[model samples]
Target chain A: MKAVAVLPGKPNSVHLREIPQPKLNDQPHAHVCSIPEGRAVLVKTLQIGVDATDREINEALYGNAPPGGEHLVIGHESFGEVLEVGAKVTELKPGDLVSCTVRRPGGSIYDKIGRNDITSEETYYERGINLCHGYMTEMFVDDAEYMVKVPPQLRHLGVLSEPASVCAKAIDQAYLAQHRLQVWSPKRAFVLGAGQIGLLATMMLKLRGLDVYTLATKPGPHRKSEIATAYGATYVSTKQESMHDLAKRVGKP
Target chain B: MKAVAVLPGKPNSVHLREIPQPKLNDQPHAHVCSIPEGRAVLVKTLQIGVDATDREINEALYGNAPPGGEHLVIGHESFGEVLEVGAKVTELKPGDLVSCTVRRPGGSIYDKIGRNDITSEETYYERGINLCHGYMTEMFVDDAEYMVKVPPQLRHLGVLSEPASVCAKAIDQAYLAQHRLQVWSPKRAFVLGAGQIGLLATMMLKLRGLDVYTLATKPGPHRKSEIATAYGATYVSTKQESMHDLAKRVGKP
Candidate 1:
């Protein structure tokens, strides 16, 4: 199978390579295999999103290949098509749109309860990011638990699930942290960047009925700013005015 | 009235000072005065626990005098006898044992919900620590909302209530953060430090049925270690072994 591979932490090491096609077979690594046979789903790749994480991994900033392997297959944000499912798999079927969760659980108490994203271990595992192969290839097999079905109508935006989950998880945690507040009703928000994640977060916050402010470096009447304003968010460029001044002018968000 | 006061941020400034006695009357500061008169409680100080916060304040580490005042009355942990109750007071009465909550509400959303302890504002209001006079005086009057009735049987240990609440709130927050875990039943805990707060936390965790390991710098057979063991928690002296080595010996806690 053709896949993008990188020698993690080695600058400019990204290259095309032939790798073994993933299969739903019994393997020592439970994370690498679909257990009990019936809960495994084979996904065929349709779209994979490349972001800063992939760039940084290629730049030797941080990332790792799976143990005993020479190269890491890179891609964590992906939308795919379900090509096959084991006899016992009931949640998904061939031709279904889907996306895979990146973080595989470690031995942390948090990991034991399906929150592998907040693992407490000294090391972490993220497919294609560290200690696991990500879905940057033609096909991959994983436990049904890791695959999330994307509605066929929203297939075009399915590749966004991984990135959108990042924003969603952050908002979820904020609300979780505010559980102490008992009845928190935030009216405004300040998102400090105007990147993809920031824009997506602004959209999500807007959906929740918050007045949003998206801030970026350049004084922009540009495409990014337009998208933010389209979501009814005020786009502020830090270059034109400092955050401190803005906060004082508009009050804390 | 004689109260222990400090010139905040001035080293070794703690001293006995004559201050105006508190009365249940209208004042410019709502926190300083019990408003509407009917819900106020006049508390006569019985015992005050001076902890690290006081010591640090005396050392000028961090603390502030109330606005327009040169000295800050310093005592946030105290047990008191209710000397009088407002006309409309329902929760507490004269002769009742009680303790006052430390953090006072600010303008933040958290503060508005009786969670002033977790206020998000840049400045915080804790009686005796920041902008408010504390309980190190003969008597003080406050709203009944701030006074927690201590059981008569626990009178001897009432002063511990403020400190105990600190531990209870922390544990509460831990449980709250674990809401995502759904059914998290932690079996073990590792509490670093063997200070007053640490021991209190260990005791609280023990009460919750967790096997706790309380770590300290000193070697065992000391007063703190004995106290820890008395509560059925294992005491570890980090000087004897590194945390990494300890984790390997006992598994993650």
Candidate 2:
């Protein structure tokens, strides 16, 4: 299997190399496999997306990472058919399209994004960012439970599921936490970036009825603003004002 | 108004001082307020709970603060009454009981909890932590939108809105986040710690239908375990099993 692994620090050191193919072990769970001891997944990478975290680990210091020297695979975002199952596997079968949970069990998805930005142990072990090879490989094995079925309605976006779900899950979790405090919901929000995650988060926020604002790092009179608007966001350019000011401007009744 | 300000870090050096009460002069729909801001209750705190962070900064190596000192009033978890309001205040009144949002604003409620542990200028602010004076004071003003009406149903637990909300919000957020992912709400889960946050999270989790397990730092039967189980948690001693192990245990079906 050919996978992209990052040789930390020395920039542009991402290597697309042939590693022995990952084989599936048996673990029963169409829903989620416990992180250790039960199963591994072998995914033939179909269209793994380049994540912002991959860029950060490959370039900047976003914190929440272990000192970088391990061979790091760049893409954690992936979707493909489950080619084999662990001997213990009883849930997922061959050809099932699945995605990884941006959250490894016991970790915050927010932190996962932070780690996905820089590398972290938990994020690493979950796949792509850590020792567990990302789906950039011809096949990747994961704890069966962490891999969930990508519904048929979302098959077109199945490969986008891991990343989209991260956004979805984070937003959902944020809402849950919020509701415990207040009886109402947040009807408006500010999304600081306009990249993939930002876009997805923006979309999810809109789905939840929030009047979304996408504040781009770099703004044009009508560039990212247009893209953001198309994606259900009202554009706010940081070039014109900080996120606070923008949220104030929009959040104001 | 009188408040206890954590001047610098020396706990003993805390300043018991008075500052002018907060007065809202902006338009009722000023950009300064978010909708949940209505939930933000201005409480005249009777008692403020001391948190672990205060203990660390005051007793540890943060160094003694300056003479006038950067005073931070130490109470985050608090209970209070609505004393005053701007023309915009409606959801709550001058005498209604209320609590505070663990986080500041701009993000969704779900975003707050998921990012609650992470301090961002936007997500957290107002009358707690650093940005504004905390509740360990005579009177403090907060965004009214973040407050929640105490359910008469849980009247047995005379705990304040802030503390209860923290746990309540966490548990609710966990479920909300889970449900958004695919519609499967968590029926079982684990709380990594049984401390203030953990205990609250446990209660909330249980209320959400999760069979929670508390991983206490020090095993042996203790008050926290009793509280945890009372709220429907299964106990696990951190002394006996690793959190990682416990996480794996919960990860299993």
Q: What TM-score fits each model?
A: 0.80, 0.46
Scored by lDDT, model 1 comes in at: 0.86
How many collisions per candidate? 1, 50
Candidate 2 error regions (>4 Å)? A26-41, A60-70, A86-90, A102-124, A220-224, A241-248, B1-253
Per-candidate DockQ values are: 0.32, 0.09
Clash number for candidate 2: 50
Tens digits of per-residue lDDT, candidate 1, B134-216, equal 99999987778888899999988899888889889989888887775445678899999988789999999999999999999
Collision pairs in model 1: A128-A134
lDDT of 2 at A251: 58
Q: What's the CA error at residue A163 for candidate 2, in Å? A: 1.9
- Model 2 per-residue lDDT tens digits across residues B123-192: 3444445444456776666666555555545433434556666676555555564443333434567678
Provide the lowest-lDDT 10-residue window in model 1 chain B.
B26-35
Model 1 iRMS: 3.2
